[model samples]
Target: MISAPLTRRAIFAQAWPIMLGQTTVPLVGLVDTAVIGRTGDATALAGVALGTVVINMIFWTFGFLRMGMTGMTAQAEGAGDAREVEAMLLRGVVAGVGLGVVLFALQIVLIPLALETMAGGGALDDAARGYVSARFLGAPASLAIFAINGWLFGRGRTRAALALQIVMNLVNIALNLLFVWHFHMGARGVGLGTACAEWISLAVGLAIAGRGVDWGRILSPALFGGGALRRLFAVNADIMIRTIALLSLFLWFTNAGARLGATALAANYVLMQFVSVSAFVLDGFAFTAESRVGQAIGAGSRSAMVRAIRLTGEFSLLAGIGFALLFFVLGPALIAFFASNPAVRAQAGAMLPFAAIIPAIGVPAWLLDGIFIGATRGRALRNAAILATALYIATDLLFRPFGESGIWWAFMASYLYRAVSLGAYLPGLLRTIEVAEPANGP
Candidate 1:
């Protein structure tokens, strides 16, 4: 195995590429919004937003493939157990595939329900429903891709993971242009583009795994036996609850804005893209922390954990500052890109300063989440998130008399609370340490 210092650097190196790969997906969405804006149809924009919300809700549910797998595999790696590492990957894939099938079956029921519930009555509603229905058809592929990504990241193959994501985005973008513009397929075209890209990505991911994955023992039923499946489900349940809370906040935000009116919602939506971009970038550092810190904790190396935490925290802070500055400088141009309507652009522009400040304020919470998760303190992580979210809801209720600005302030406060709560737990965590054996036939 590589030395501690080198392994840490390797983690970051892998993360940077993965970060770029991850960022490209959002960039593609931004481009899609931009292109659709030129068509001068607010319904089209609303369609994309609505469809995205539904898909994201579903996708986030399976985020366990990434979070659960990373923690389990990193620990295995740290324990110096190649067989266990292989088992984790195989179990994750099987579980993800099973979940994907379930999701596909549920989509039939879900699409109509979502349209009625989330999409307001109008042409926009019709467009959103159409888009969602088409996209739902690719549930299996999308979930499969999510599983593949989680396994890859867990194995510390960040570059390969990044490459797969980039390819997916590139394919999606090309298809978006071809179907939406060339064929005049409109919202349905965009959905089709996403579906096609997902399948392609799943195929590529499987091929890549075949090349590098140790296959001799992977096919054994022991890998997916009762004990393994139970552990997988248990971890997944924890993550799913956490993700549901997280996604519910955004959904609530969207729904709340919708109640205020489309213009407000649209403006908020535009601003949210900025938040998404910033969070994804910050997540690169977080993912690095998850892998490195989990490995450190598993290896029973207190020193490695301390160092990993320090490096990740410092780097996240630096990265957050850069994102803050980027938002400050490019605020206008970015807002204008998503919003062509004068009112939407103006309102979003006014909100730019608040949005720009979020990364810096939220970085601590984000980084802490990674640290805690790596340490396998998921219960703490869940509690911290729940507490912060409750704080946010309470603050929002009290501040509702103000305006949108008040809501943004509440959002900022939530991040602050999360950071503080998680930070408070760190001292106790550092006092306890457990290291795994080395990987060479441990």
Candidate 2:
């Protein structure tokens, strides 16, 4: 799509930027925590944390805006459908902003219900409510930015995407410091900062993406064409359900750990950070696979699709192994850093081996997700995710008697199930590649 051949160099070129952008995402939260914690206001700190959790849960549900946009836009680009490419961006933006508006409208009801369920009635709930109110104001911008970034990734504009992420993170950090440290507005200040940064990023994203584009056709009747709208919604709906299923699995995992004891919960939380870090890094390759495979399919080249899978898989495997080794060698120190409490640190250390091996064990599942996402095989993804999650819950319940280690075992089993279930659909996905080889081709 970028007029460059797909090679390892090209793949890394696309991937590294995405990885860097993803890694920056956590920094925004870290800055919020640091600025709020320094005030010695434990209530404010906890409120911000709770608020963040709620916002992430809500926003993540709409992540289909990004994933769906990426697949559709990449296919359009691969097919050399320049008009459709532009239309896809407009459709994604409209959908994103529209969904954000719906979320904003529902905040009055959603906020109280979510906070009450998570924190119950207390000063904590009030504080979290304040934070959520401020942060939720930028819902329109935040969700719209997801579509913008997805469009950029679909077009293989990784550098542009990375640039936007860096800009947003920097803006967020700066505003957070000013609001929390200087203004001393507490948790609300943190939320306000993030919201302001999001609006700024939205403007910046539009400016970047709108350059050299024909807005006339993009805003035309074809943008709302019935068939296209149906396909877009169908894909988005499937991805959303698939995402929710995975979220449910992790929620269960966390809830199960909580039942074990406070120390176990803290240890599990710390251990999850290790998994998250590796996931963000390895996601680079997964994302690359999505774009490449989508392109190959769009062009109706099964050979190209095979090559994409092979190359992305190889890179993902290597990166996963590297992460596992790093986690194994530095397990104790990392645990100590995340968890200062002696009991939590020790509990996490005992289970560190499980976390260490997870990157390697999780590689296949992660890669398969990318492959399917790229192929835009939403039904296959949805089915696999649901089935795997059910199996995971059963395994978790069956191993409940083994204590914390059993939870880890169930977690590992979840990854295996995901990989296997997705692999089951991969053959059918390949069959959908409508190949048309040239008669004189060697």
Give TM per candidate: 0.93, 0.89
- Write one digit per residue (lDDT tens) for candidate 1, span 1-442: 2124634476578569767886997787777777666676767777777777877877777887878788777878877888888777667767777787888788878777766667366877777777777787777778767767776766677888888988899999999899888998888888889888888888888887657667896778787776888987786676677777777666666666666666666777777788878888888888888877778777787767777788777778988999999999998998877778887788788878888999888899888877876666767777777777777788888988877887788877878988997798998888887543455522
Name the regions of candidate 2 deviating beyond 4 angstroms: 1-3, 29-53, 115-133, 177-190, 260-267, 338-344, 439-442
- In the range 247-327, model 2's lDDT, one tens digit per residue, is 778767766765665466556766776787788778888888888888887888787788888988999999999999999
Clashes of each: 8, 0
* Model 2 CA lDDT for position 297: 77
- Runs with alpha carbons beyond 4 Å of true place in candidate 1: 1-11, 116-119, 435-442
What C-alpha lDDT does candidate 2 achieve relative to the native structure? 0.82
* Residue 223 local lDDT, model 2: 75
